[model samples]
Target: MSHTEKEATLYRMSTAEHQCPYGLKTKHLLKSNGYTVDDQLLTSREETDRFKEKQNVQTTPQVYINDKRIGGYEEVRKHLGKPLPDPDEKSYQPVIALFAMTALLAIAASWLAFGSFLSIQTVEWFISFSMVVLALLKLQDVEAFSTMFLNYDLLAKKWVPYGKIYPFAEGLAGLLMAAEFASVISIPVAFFIGSIGAVSVFKAVYIDKRELKCACVGGSGNVPLGFISLTENIMMVAMAVWMFISMF
Candidate 1:
């Protein structure tokens, strides 16, 4: 076919009650890729079912190219060489988003408190906010986080309960640090956990040369354990030390 003759036929459900989003996406993709679409709508429930039965297909948003069945949304994407994302793929998106959001929040918080967008307190807020958010992510599935934590955490390996308690401890330290209250308690807690975590991550990723998923983002995430994971632990350690010195 000529460049201007690229043609596609789409059969998608667009009933009065329900509209399929994937159908819209497929249509948009076809148009963006310079295809002329012969849009066919299965307007009612009965009509959709009959169309599926006649076509011998189970799903909506079916695509046809040159009268040959190109399949549904996902299959059409594959035919166009644009496959869907794999959730289990190892990526740093979760951690990157977390740090970026916390940094912005810190700046906003500093502005609210000290009447400036950037300040020493902004750095403190960033660390505390990150700790709280990270702890919250782990708290989503404590059992899962604990299971993963035991893989590299020395304390968790030694005392199994520590795996479970780590999230709560981290959160408490963060809250106390943010409030600038009970330095005696928060300082020590942060320092102890941070120190242990830094050592454990160093041993696992650098010394032992192990490849593992990081629980730093969440139990279910697939972000690889590496320098970024090490950086998180180092940040915690530095924050704790900074808090201690500032207090004295």
Candidate 2:
């Protein structure tokens, strides 16, 4: 066949009641890739079902190149040699959202408590609130969190139970600190865990040059093990030390 004669066919749903987005996307993709498309629209539910039955396909937005079936959007991309992005790709979005929300909450709380939005108390509350949020994310699925935590946490790697208990300990310390109560236990807990976490993150990302997902939020999170993880631990350690010094 001549290059000028190259043609593709697309079957998509475009009824009076509904229009398929995938169908539009597939059509756009084909046109952008330089294929002349013979667009076929199924105008009714009955017509769509019949087309699916006749084609022996289960989904809409089916494509054909030179009369050879090329499947849907995903398959078409593969056929065009473009790899689909991984759905589980690592990202800092989850951690970023968590910290942002925690900071906002801390400001609100500090204002209510001391009539000041920006103060040493606000920083302490921010750290405490962040710990609570992170703990809750881990507690959502303890088993999953523990598995991911073990990947790089020095204490969790050595003693498996530490992985399971870490979330609860973090939550307890955060609650106590936020309320300005039980500093005796909360300060020590935060210091010990935060110190261990800082060392572990530094070793994993800087010393060993390992690439891994962070369990600071949870196992399902795609947060990378690097600066964000180190920052979280350092914040906790600083809060613990400041609170401890104030106690004396």
Which is the leading candidate under TM-score? 1
- List the global CA lDDT of all models: 0.91, 0.92
Q: In candidate 2, what are the lDDT values of residues 1-248, reduced to their tens digit?
A: 57744578999999888999999999998899888999999999999999999999999989998778999999999988888978789888888888899999989988998898999888888899999999999999999999999999999988999999999999999999998899999999999999999999999999999999999988798889999999999988998999999988
Summed backbone clashes in each candidate are: 0, 0
Model 1 lDDT, full chain set: 0.91
Identify the runs in model 2 with alpha carbons over 4 angstroms from their true place.
1-51, 60-85
* Decoy 2 TM-score against native: 0.73
TM-score of each: 0.90, 0.73
Which 10 consecutive residues of model 2 have the lowest summed lDDT? 1-10
Residues 115-229, candidate 1: write the lDDT tens digits: 9999989999999999999999999999999999989999999999999999999999999988889989888899899889989999999999999998887789898998888
Best-performing candidate as measured by lDDT = 2
